[model samples]
Target: MQLKTKSRLKFTIASLLIVIFAYILSNGLIIGDYQIKSLGSITKLGLDLKGGVYIEEEIKGENISKDTIDRTKELIELRVNALGVNESVVTVTQQNRIRIEIPGVYDAENALKQIGKTGKLTFRGPNNDIVITGEDIKDASVGVNQQTNQPVVQLKLNESGTKKFAEATAKYQGKVISIYMDEELVSAPVVKSVITTGEAIIEGSKDIEEAKRLAGIIKSGALPVELVPATVKTIGPSLGADAIPTSKKAAVIGITLVMLFMAIYYRIPGIIADLALAVYIMLTMLIFTTALKATLTLPGIAGLLLSVGMAVDANVLIFERIKEELKLGKSLRSAVDAGFNRALPSILDSNITTIIAGLVLMWLGAGQVKGFALTLVTGVVCSLFTAVTVTKFLLKNFVNSNWIENKKMYGA
Candidate 1:
């Protein structure tokens, strides 16, 4: 009775573990700031799956230097990304135009307006207190400070700004106030006096050119570059909307049929193999969504299906080897161990070669090719684990528990 209880406990624990693993993959995990998104939610569908706005714009100038173009592109990317856009493809074209393709974004006009806004500038005091904001900033100019005869920036603020500045300067007198442009610290000057004027002088430019650059930087921080929209168009989802549902249905049907076949052919071992295969599916989806974050393109789905088939094939190979050993009058335990050992080399060799090919494709290919390669590699690795570790665990537990004593149940 005690032995039976121990066996039941072991089996229950194993079953619970499998259930927990599956749940984790499906529901994901969140601990404080760290989070793992659910498999379906984290897997981003490509532009092919979701229609969006396509925009093309170029920097306004003749013979624009590459550095300037790069800077402009960087700023545009930063602006868009900072606005909470995800998976936005911003690429520079041959004509030096910046093309932005954002999947699932439909409002081109508002998106353009919001993305090009010159971010707010602020003055922060001790403990990161907001001393003053840029609500009343009017114009900034570069000029020579009369007293020092040095190049400086002249800033004009409205009446509201003047009052706030005067109050902050008087309150935080002798303390430091850091100036920030788009959250980047441009300057941190100590307050020397409380002036009630609306105009302020920023001194510290080494030369006229430096003063001009600083003035331009501040002005740009207040006013973003003019974006001349060359073209604004909406693209339909490259893949039809029905593609995902159809692919998912196909995957479900295929996996179900394969599991049924395994159970029918190999009997007890087949059932164990099916369990491992189920785990393989969960792990692959988790890797796809969390680890690689690979977009689920059509080719990606194909690769995943192919890998699933390979996982079944791996189980078949091991089961065949086990059957052969059992036919040679080996004990179930000996047969299982020897079969797995013999199958290991072949499985590793084939999977390793496929993984290498997938890596090569990832290195050389782009777009869907890389997606296919990524899923392919991920699937192969997961299948390797299910075939070797998961299958072994299930088989050992069944045999040790003496759930089935007949070799015939193993398809021997």
Candidate 2:
């Protein structure tokens, strides 16, 4: 039984090492068109680390409700989207304020102009006559046309507003039904037919971009209240670009020191813990890039570093328990088992509380806080996996192989 368990444990370690190496090589070395694009792609960045324009729009008006703040947020989000800045952030701040962060964008002025307007969604007749106001519309979505390779914004009318839309479409079929945001003719769809139903398609054009912008505007819906720009601030990406190299250096130093400490303190079990930690790190990166689609910010890198400490702490706790058991004259094999079993409850209780804190941050925090919370949560989850399962599995195999029988090496 002992020999069988020992062989199985070694095989398991070897298999895990092979799988980890294969995963890394397959993702990094395979270079197709798609792979090449991915290679050039810097990981998605958050507002602080990537650095772009930061604009604050103060809400004005008497008796401004929570709903009004929410509406302003939605409208600002739409305008930010119209600016063609990808991965923008729009958040509602305290004291009736809205904050906008546009990441990795160069033309701050253009982006500012795009979002600085009083958002108005309008529908116009063929002769540029006003048909209906944005308040009449209920919902809008960007959709792909099955028949034609084009995008369209499908608008839904309010129940009471259906008659107005039907009448407008009846007179405007085969003519341009223009949708506007302030003076901009966002969508000019040629009406196909006149129907009483509330649905209408704002057709895409030779420029698919216009369709996308219109879609964002319509999808944002009408703001319940108007907003005036209170403040606008722009930060250059150059600053973020400078900080990234520093973050990378910190990550390297942090990981290297942790690995060295583990090996020096715990000997064989410490070595196993280090190996598991490596696996933990690799898996965390893979999940961040491929699963959660997280943007790695400087704070996010800091969260990763913190998690490395937590992972090491978990191992230290378990190893210390083993040492205590050995001091009580327990056998090497029994000491290892009792150590894990005894330390587990405390380990679980501590990390579970931290995980709860992470969940709260994810709920209430936006932008960088969200990124930091997400990375920390992922790290906690992966640490539990590595410390509890991976380390235990490795130690079980090592002990069964009769590799280290001395209680001194176990740090008794």
Candidate 3:
């Protein structure tokens, strides 16, 4: 009797703690100035969810090489990052075009002005002769001047650039070598000495942020091929705002019905399954908000809902197996063990196959398809753990506690 009491106490405490943690994760906690954001707020929403602008730009010249297109895409991504847009995606698309998706950005014209510029960097002499181009730049980084403690951009040049720069410095030691980006004057630094080691520095940035921005632009290099904006469109946030609440309602209603059905039909085991399901939901959201940093989309929500159903289905299978074992005159503990053991193969086969399919979709698909695959795979994996491990552990503890040993409660 004492052992049973201890077991029940431990199980009750554990279950309560799990519930509290899940609640905290879903709704967050706040104490004074300290606050934890809920999973929904922490997880990033995709362009479809947050509503931003997408621009498709086509290469102007015909028969553009793959290398050129890839380079352009990379540069565009860097420029987008420089614009302080987080979670922007730059993808090479069909017909020698590249697509850029900037989420949470509403100013389409400003975004275009920042990312679509040619950014052709050049150093010109007194007579306006080109001394070096962006292609000659090997690297550019923001650094501080050790002597003055001021922000500056350090440049590393290629071999040809080094030779040309050395000549330019020698020819105009006390004269200004003006730097230009797409014909707009950026800087004019006087050549103090001939630099033969291929390294240079640009000073006079107003602050560290300005220095970093200039460095980022220079580091991205110029686009290899000219590009023209093929299409530009903006998605309004109102649409996403509407979809989010609807998705939440659907998930809540569906999960509630599943939980009610499980508790009604399966009794004790169903309640435990619902607890495990809660853990699964918390775990999935934790992954999306932290490890994966996944962007939630409408399709991703569908995947999440589908995986929730799968989790319940797994629990149902195990409960039915337990009922069969109970009918065979097995003891309660033996029936529980045998049920999980027997259901293991089927559970593994289904989850494994689904995971494989999700991986394939993630690999081959793009945009919303990829988002769906990511959430589906993550949710399915979490479900497998909760079903095979968490649910089994909880059920075993309840059985050992002997608090509710009635065969009817076990659905026998």
Best by TM-score: 3
Candidate 3 structure, TM-score to reference: 0.76
lDDT of 2 by residue, 1-412 (tens): 5685765678477648846664654355454654422311536777677878877777678898774565566566767777666678788876677888888776767876677655677789977888877778787766777898687777888976688889988898788878787665666778889958888776755555556556556655555566677877777777677888888788789889988988888887888888888778867777887787767777788888899899888899999999999999999889999999999998999889989999899898876787789999999999998899888887777777775677787688
How many pairs of residues in model 1 come into backbone collision? 0
Reference-based lDDT, each prediction:
0.78, 0.77, 0.86
Q: In model 2, what are the clashing residue pairs, if there are any?
A: none
- Point out the higher-scoring one by TM-score: 1 or 3: 3
The list of candidate 3 runs beyond 4 A from truth reads: 1-6, 60-70, 94-96, 120-156, 159-220
TM-scores, all candidates, are 0.65, 0.72, 0.76
Backbone clashes in each candidate structure, one number apiece? 0, 0, 0
Candidate 3 global lDDT: 0.86
Model 1 worst lDDT run, 10 consecutive residues = 216-225
lDDT of 3 by residue, 175-251 (tens): 99998766656678888888889998988899997787667656656776777888999998888899999999999
Sorted by TM-score (best first), the order is: 3, 2, 1
RMSD of each: 10.2, 7.3, 8.2
lDDT by residue (1-412, candidate 1, tens digit) is: 6654666577668767888877776788898999966677777776566777778886676777664555466556655665566766666676767877677877888768755666767878867888777776676688997888999888777788788888888988888888776766667777778868977877777898767655555554544445578888786775548888888899999999899999999999998898899899998987787676556767888899989988887899899999999999999989999999999888889989999999999887765677789889999999999999988888877777877889999978
Candidate number of the best lDDT:
3
Candidate 3 residue 60 Cα shift, in angstroms, is: 4.9
Candidate 2, superposed: residue stretches over 4 Å from native? 1-27, 31-42, 118-222, 357-371, 403-409
